[model samples]
Target: MKSPSPGRSSAVRSMRSAPFFTPIRVVFSFAGPSARRPLSFFSPTIRPSAWRGRPWKALRLVPLLSQNFKAEVVAVLMLILFFSWCYCSYVLGCWRLNIALSWFWWRHLDAGLHAVMHGDFRTRHDIQAGLFWIYSLLSHRAMEYYYGARELKGNGMSKHWWHHIYPNDPGRDPDWSTMTGVAWVRRHTSAQWHPCHQWQCWYWLPVSMFLEPLFELIQVACALLEAVASLLEPPMNGPYVSRWAHVLGFLCEVLFNPGFQLVAFGVQPFWKALGVLLLARATSRLLLYPFSEVQHYMPEHILNREAADDSAEWVIGQLLCTANLEFRNRWAWLMDFLMFHGDSHQIEHHLWPAMSFVQYTKASQVVRATCARLRLPYYTVGYFEGYQKICEQVKEHRKPPPRPKRPRSPGEEPSPSESSSTRTRRRTRGS
Candidate 1:
């Protein structure tokens, strides 16, 4: 077989990288903030502007979204990169980069450095997040099987093992943790639950879409910084990386990161490189943002914060606190093929992390039916409905249901159904 071309490999890598949108999706979402309007490519009207200034306005955009298949395809791919660059802030004047979240991360990382000096933390929080990886992988098992880093059993405390082992413990279950944003809840949060949490419903979707791309960037930066910091730590604390090894690892960090790696994936021209990386990274991140925050971030997940630890067996714990979705959809295989698989069947993935994407459907069915037989919660919600539920929960979070009073008279105690009604009324009043 002929060797795969660099561009072909790059295309695959870019798709696998988180962050993207189809060119069509971008055009529709391109209305200005002030005159907000969705794209109308599907509409007979070519121009979707509220101003109705130029009916031909969309004609200029037509080359980018043509009727011709190959041209349209190319245009769409370019738009993904263009918009990704716009959102990722690789170029300015496209869109705002690092809005509400950039400051948050800045402060968070600053506090981390401060902790390295004082404030009860042993190491910088930034470094702590990384646990000091010279280079990281999407799956550490891939690292072990292919790269022969067999010592990294689940990458030793940084990977999903902690989440599987600890489930929903705020400290250990990485899935059940929050890195930043307002600290809510009286128990686990650094800040008291604020009235503002009610407005999260309003802001989270748009803000998360904007802020999510930076999340991976910030995470990688911290990881690399910790790796650098590790080099300075005592040998007992740091991995023994020789000078040559350090150089190689540093290159790997830059080249292996999804963003930079996408850029370097192909032997294409500069613009093509940018476009490819832009398409894959931005589209992946954009589609991922809405669902990503909702995962393990529903209101019930937060209410469980009263407990510091969990005792459920690992499998059951995953079923209890984690959620699943109706992944048996048209796009399930496409998502799987693109390498961001099984998230729609998140519980199944956790239960069998290394299972092939092709096998996930059967595995999911087995797990779901088994969990149902055992009377465990094995939720499988539609994609849009799942997001809708999460949005509703965010709005309702501030107003918890009122507690029922004990019976004073023989018949004073509310029955189970009555208690539910009374609770509903209180919740309504609180809202």
Candidate 2:
């Protein structure tokens, strides 16, 4: 075999050190006698390096927990506890609780709107007249339930209706890939709001708000009835079955109540459910518009038109398409969470969508470093600061004054000094 050039030998050695290309380097090393001297000299050191050692050690340890019966039992117990708490909290409303609460108010507003539209303006105050305290309590409960269900569904790892209803199903696999499902939703449904586009109608807003309160109150009443009924039933034998029942209870609270609210009061209520929905929509647009522009609209990150394959590029595309929300102010963090702060750890979520929110922050530092190496945008802004900027951009886009087109002159000649002055002005403006 011919001797390899020194540059080629160095390049091969470098490629071998890289994690993914290591196997290729090993193959090349064995194929050429000229590769042996450099390989033997450098390969031993590379193979035993701490960088290589830690990952291999960690990989080896993963199966040990499964192999040991005691460890497996402990793992299962921990998993049960974790999921149980998640289910209870989801049913009880730890996330987006305000939305559920506002459902009651939405019902009232919806009713009033309907009454007004039907030329019953006198009924406007009637919805709130006798129902103030009841509506308020139901609203709070509904908000709690709404946020709880959202968190439960998000944490459940499945986008399916069945999974939302019975999340703790032992047969249910929580690690199913969300990319395809999320992509389908993004393509078929609006990213900023629910898949149903009916909420966009302006007239429905008041009606929804008016009727939501009453609808939510009925849901709460039904839930209490179901709980009392469950208590009267024979106790479930298996732990899984009991867990499933608890999950079902939460599902009942979330779906049955809200489901009835939508169906009985009609879909018109969502249109008039203005307070929380409006705030949520406005907050989301403010956060996402600039975010989308920076991550997707920018020339550097835009998806290629000619490339039919969206495989490897899509992963990179996600990293490029999302930016981190860095909060400088303490209040910004609270506000961010209130308005989809899950977005702050976006890159990590994209990389490992199944990971719990608790794990996301831990993974963020590593993900950020990886993104930095790739030269992708890792956007971080103080919560309110970013929100304010996005609002400003929206206002700018909305402001109307069309620029007049400059008229073209036929064979216009400019003096050298005039041209130089214009060039200077153009350069200054460009800078």
Candidate 3:
């Protein structure tokens, strides 16, 4: 036989090296380089291989629901449950529980009674602190795992990890974030009232102990009922109740109970409950306002500010004025997670909002490194420490000492620089 041509020999060698030298390869081998023109088109075929076959199948289910009445019914049911849970946990559970519990505790106390009435800060601290811990422990593990898995799968960059990872259809992009009503309220209020709002202290102090409890109680009852209903009924495995009942339950147990308890017990005078309620409403605005300032108000942190110019700018502006409390202590971490770790992780969450708690630690490490490189402050501390700092600032602002005018040096004129230096010295002296 004639010796194989060099091209043929090379093709034979390539065939041996290739993983699947099937009929297609043989056909291509005979077609020569001119046929290679079409091979480039086949490259995209490999891209689909990266996704497991199941992901595509799973993704196909998204569009099925939009076509018929059954799907719409299911969708509506899911939405209702979601709204109910949100209302119950946040509004009634957190706000109401705080007021109820606080009122209960306060009824028996003297006029001078306070959270510190139990001798030390332990009683009041325990209530908030315990709630925070419980919330963190129950929710953090699952949330972290869910979030971490998304990060590992290259889907952790978005705000709502669940919807993105398992998108219902082609119409929606895989990485979209949705804001609930409460979240919206929190964001808008915080953004509108920081730094420039001199009434922040007056707003937050009393409200936390009164009006918030009533709303919170409504949330709590709703959550409790939903959870109980879930346990009694064979889980509908519906979109709303199946996946999120635990979230509602956790919120009720952690946030609602303590907040309400604090309100009831922390404040005194049964008649003052009205004042406390008004204060609670104002403080709700204050807490949310500062929170929004830091997250939604700030330009860098605002999610979709460009679309809604006013809202976006408002959020960015809030972040600029508001400060974050970074918790570092293990206990503090536990407490914050329990009470509403979201508040504690505000800065980091804004920085890498999609990362799960597990991945958040790693993401936070990277964040710390980046912040260090940029010479920016990374405010991470213990929960208690952060809370203490806020309290101190509030207290200081509320009862600021009258600034005494500087005594003019005998026969010497007071200069602007000298006055500033004197003020600075005084401010720092005790602080």
Give the C-alpha lDDT of model 1.
Answer: 0.40
Ten-residue region with minimum lDDT total, candidate 2: 114-123
Model 2 earns a TM-score of 0.30
**Which model is ahead, 1 or 2, in terms of TM-score?**
1
RMSD of 3: 23.2
Estimate, for each residue in 1-431, the C-alpha lDDT of model 3 and write its tens digit: 01112232222334334454332222222233312221111121322332234322322121101122331232234334433543543345444543333322122121111111111112132332232233322232232222232123223232233322222211232221222122211212222223423554565545444555556657755865675565555545433433353544344334333233223333345445444444444444444433322232232222332333333332222222223556556775543332222345544443222222222343455545554664544544443544454555444444323468988879897699988998999999979
Candidate maximizing lDDT: 1
Could you tell me every candidate's TM-score relative to the true structure?
Answer: 0.45, 0.30, 0.28
In terms of TM-score, which candidate is stronger, 2 or 3? 2
Q: How accurate is candidate 2 locally (lDDT)?
A: 0.35
lDDT against the true structure, per candidate, is 0.40, 0.35, 0.34
Best candidate, TM-score:
1
In angstroms, the error of model 2 at 356 is 1.9
Error of 3 at 357 (Å): 2.5
Minimal lDDT window, size 10, model 3: 111-120
Q: Can you write out model 2's per-residue Cα lDDT over 327-426, one digit (the tens) per residue?
A: 5666755333332213456555443332323334556666566556656556555545554553343333332334576665888777688799999999
Off by over 4 Å in 3: 1-204, 219-324, 328-356, 359-362, 374-431
